[model samples]
Target: MSEARPYGFEVVRLARLEARLVVYDWAWARDNAERVTENWRRRVAGQPALFDGPVLLACDCAIVGEVCRLSLFETTYARFLAYRDGGSPDGHVANAFAAIVPWSADGAVLLGRMGAHTANAGQIYFPCGTPDPGDVRGESVDFSGSAGRELLEETGLDLPEDAPEDWVCLRGEGQLAFLRPVRFSDAAATLIDRMETHAIREDEPELSGIVAVRSAADIDAAMPGFVRAYLASAFDAGARARRRRT
Candidate 1:
């Protein structure tokens, strides 16, 4: 958790992302609802308030210069979960999550273990969440605000409004994760200790604990695939740089 090796990440930010609803896949949704409900009941004890929320599914993405142009459409949370859990094959619905890879000055990366009561219990990932209605500003998505809010809410750490940023997007299966790398002045141990304390002291905290990943070997099965993928590339770059320095 305490090392001085630099992560050397290029920070990215998403100033604005467009989002909107699409044509109803009534036939698919009708068939998918029952399975989604049952699966939800199994995975989540009791019921979380189900809403006809907008889930941003990526229909197409192309890099136009540095910006990624994503064709996104909206669907309900129920339908999104169905596609997420593989109960439905409808690629029409995609879940979009925004997160920041918090890197300590000492090169350690902090991750969070989700609390049991949460939907992704025991799963480890960077502090992030699904973009909700509040994230919608006018007709555009506020990715930076969402990432900043989630980081503060979960770990009690805040990145300045003017923090340097770069948008890094990753996709797998039917899901897309939009990530921003945020650097912290704190060392890894300090951040981990502070986050762990926050998780314990906060009321009904969403995170169970903080995990410090210093190397690719530190990544475990509990972490989401996207996290492991990102860390692997980062650590590999660090290793190569160190080798060259030596």
Candidate 2:
């Protein structure tokens, strides 16, 4: 596939999100235990920073009104990683994640490049991570909280507690990415400086650097389908609007 040619996905606008913990057996993980282990071993050998820990996977999802509700269950990261490279063996579950789409006041959106030690090394996308047990409050998973937590952990930047309620889900490649758009009053350059400073101070940073997307041209192959879809629509529209105002 061309760098970004195969990157195709559907975007769904959402005003709210609800994820509930579910009891379901993942037959793929169970059925392919040996394969998952071998794949994970090879990955770790190349990138020792990867961890095969607990992560939540989506069992079911339905968009009702402005809300995206998901039924999720815990699974090993190794299993999810295995399916990410190889097509889903069971065809029912997906590695659902939440991401914070950081937009600058000047209509620029920022994406992060993964560090070499990461599983997705060299890939560029919004700061995100799969839902885990900590994301679950009682029976419901707080995806918004998860998104904010990931952005902060990855960039050392704090999102406002009062970010807008708007949300979007990009569905493709057996993954459901719940994205919450958060705007920064600072310009994209300023945001990049702060993030780079944070990375320098950290002992082990997840991101190697940040790239700002100002238009569809800025969207590229390093991003997954979901990330590409969002930027192609949102950033392109934003650029058009800015031009019209000019």
Candidate 3:
């Protein structure tokens, strides 16, 4: 059998409620797990000094007609693990980005599923802006651009030009704030209408589908506790703004 090609990030599909990722790997990740973990740790440390903790690397290999390797490196210390190299004084960050938690009208949240090219499919959130390897520092995809890019790349959604602009950045208590944008008020409704009337292409073999949750409680119920907490803060900020206007 031919060796699997090196892995690269790619969006397989986009659903009204979630986006799917496909991370491909033919060999058992275990062979390079430790080295990969250490390399990531070193990378993290070299970035701006932030949190502290042992970075935990978790991964899985799925064999479904094809072999795929999934890996995750997580740490509780927000500073050490969550900080990106772009924000660091020294250069060297991964050329990867994610849409953290995307929301639809009626407060339904979108999540992504893992596929042949993904580490793990999880809930969708705010679309984060990031720079390519050669791009200038701080030059990232704006909120609108990121959302549109993610929607198109993941789900092939040609979102209308009149998408909403309610968003927030989830930085540390006071360190740096990462922006999260909501493209539409009725994103779920818009998505449902699209799915029902639109024709979906199956050319991509990586993404599975997007999943939606109706309420904050529903999101918490479907996702990990930590994820729930992270999402809550974003939603809470929006709620607070709404309350102020009222």
lDDT of 3 by residue, 92-130 (tens): 211233343555767776654434433223433332323
lDDT by residue (97-135, candidate 2, tens digit) is 899999987878888999999888999979998889999
Reference-based TM-score of each model: 0.82, 0.93, 0.44
Q: Which digits, one per residue and each the tens of the lDDT, describe model 1 over residues 15-108? A: 4444443334445768767887776666555435334466555556554445655555555666667667783376554566779889898988
Candidate 2 regions with alpha-carbon error over 4 angstroms: 1-6, 239-246
Assess each prediction's global lDDT (C-alpha) against the native. 0.70, 0.85, 0.38
* Model 1 worst lDDT window (10 residues): 1-10
Which order, best to worst by lDDT? 2, 1, 3
The number of the candidate with the highest TM-score is: 2
How does candidate 2 score on lDDT?
0.85
True-structure lDDT of candidate 3: 0.38
- Clashing pairs for model 1 are 11-165, 11-166, 12-165, 12-166, 12-167, 13-165, 13-166, 13-167, 57-94
